[model samples]
Target: MKVIAFGASTSSTSINKALATYTAGLVDGAEVKVLNISDYSVPMFSEDLEKEIGQAEGAQAFLRDLADADALVISYAEHNGHYPAAFKNLFDWATRIDREVFKNKPAVYLSTSPGPGGAQSVLAAAVGSAPFFAGNVKASLSVPNFYDVFDLEAGQVKDDAVNAQLKEAVAKLA
Candidate 1:
């Protein structure tokens, strides 16, 4: 399967990015394409901007990437218990181009943070609103206390239990 994976944040050193990419790699025999949401930068969406620019190339390109994917893996980074502005902006623009931005592809949503809450609020929001955006959610996982559970240098999950749970979640796609 061609799995399109991305962290919904623009941070250069986003832990959510690491988690998303690493989790995507767990799918056996799958080709993973990692997307940097920052690369698909669109101006903050607004009716005025929509009228001025018609459509943003970044949003179009972002949609094209999703269109080619057989499945999706998105890890969200939370800011004040909500989506980071960078991600929300691109997402808003993409929605304008195609309300079904996920293209009805099966998806696994994930979130992580340095705290025990694990960014669950945003994950819940994503999962809750997924159907409206045509997201075919297969499963979801939240990895809390990221620095403790994941080994940055090894680029792998260190906790055996979390690793097992992660495997179980990804298995839904197969």
Candidate 2:
């Protein structure tokens, strides 16, 4: 399987990005492509901007990447209990080009945070609304207290129970 993975955040040191890349690596025998959303930067979305620049190249390119994927693993970073502004802006532009940005690919949604909330608010929203955007959600997980469960130096999940759950969730893609 060709799995495309990304963390929906623009932070250079985004923990969500690390989590997404690590989770994508769990898919046995799959070729994984991890994207850095900051690389596909687009100016904030607006009707006026859309009228001025039709479809932004960044959005189109991002959508094309999604089109090429057999499946996706996305980890969302929550800001004020919702999506980060950068991701939401890119998504808005992508939707203008292709409403089905996920391109009907099966997807696994993930989220995490240093706090106990686990960024569940955004994860739940992503999983819940995925179908409307042609995201075939196979499974979803929210890892709470990211710093505790993830070992930055080891570059993997350290908590056994969370690791097991992540493995199980990713396995559903098969």
Candidate 3:
């Protein structure tokens, strides 16, 4: 499968990105391309910015990525129990260009956090509405207490249970 994966967070050292990448690795014969939203720099979603900038080069490129992708793996970062402002802006910008960037494409929804809640709120928010926006939402997972379950330097999950569940989710999605 041609998988387009991305972390919803724009942080330079995003654990969510690591989780998405790790999940991509679990799929055999899958071609994975991970994206960083910060590189896109979509101007804060406002009609004013849209009219003035007419969409950033990055957003257009992102749309193209979605068009070519067979599947999407998104690991949403929780910002106060919601999507990061940057990712929300990107989603808004994408909708402006293509009402269905997803277009029923299979999606593996995921989230992770250092907190015990493990980005549950953000994942729920996305899974709840992503289908309305053309996502064939697949299995979901949230790694809780991220530091305890994932090793940043290794870029891998530490707990056996977490890894097992994640592997299962990836296999099902693939």
In the range 9-31, model 1's lDDT, one tens digit per residue, is: 99989999999999999999999
Clashes of 1: 0
TM agreement with the true structure for every prediction: 0.98, 0.98, 0.94
Q: lDDT for model 1, on a 0 to 1 scale? A: 0.93
Give the lDDT of residue 20 in candidate 2.
93
lDDT of 2 at 39: 86
- Residue pairs clashing, model 3: none
lDDT of 2 at 51: 99
lDDT at residue 55 of model 3 (Cα atoms): 68
Residue 156 displacement (Å), model 1: 0.7
- Model 1 TM-score (2 dp): 0.98
For each candidate, what is the lDDT? 0.93, 0.93, 0.87
Kindly give the number of clashing pairs for every candidate.
Answer: 0, 0, 0
Which sections of candidate 3 miss by over 4 Å?
none
Cα deviation of 157 in candidate 1 (Å)?
A: 0.4
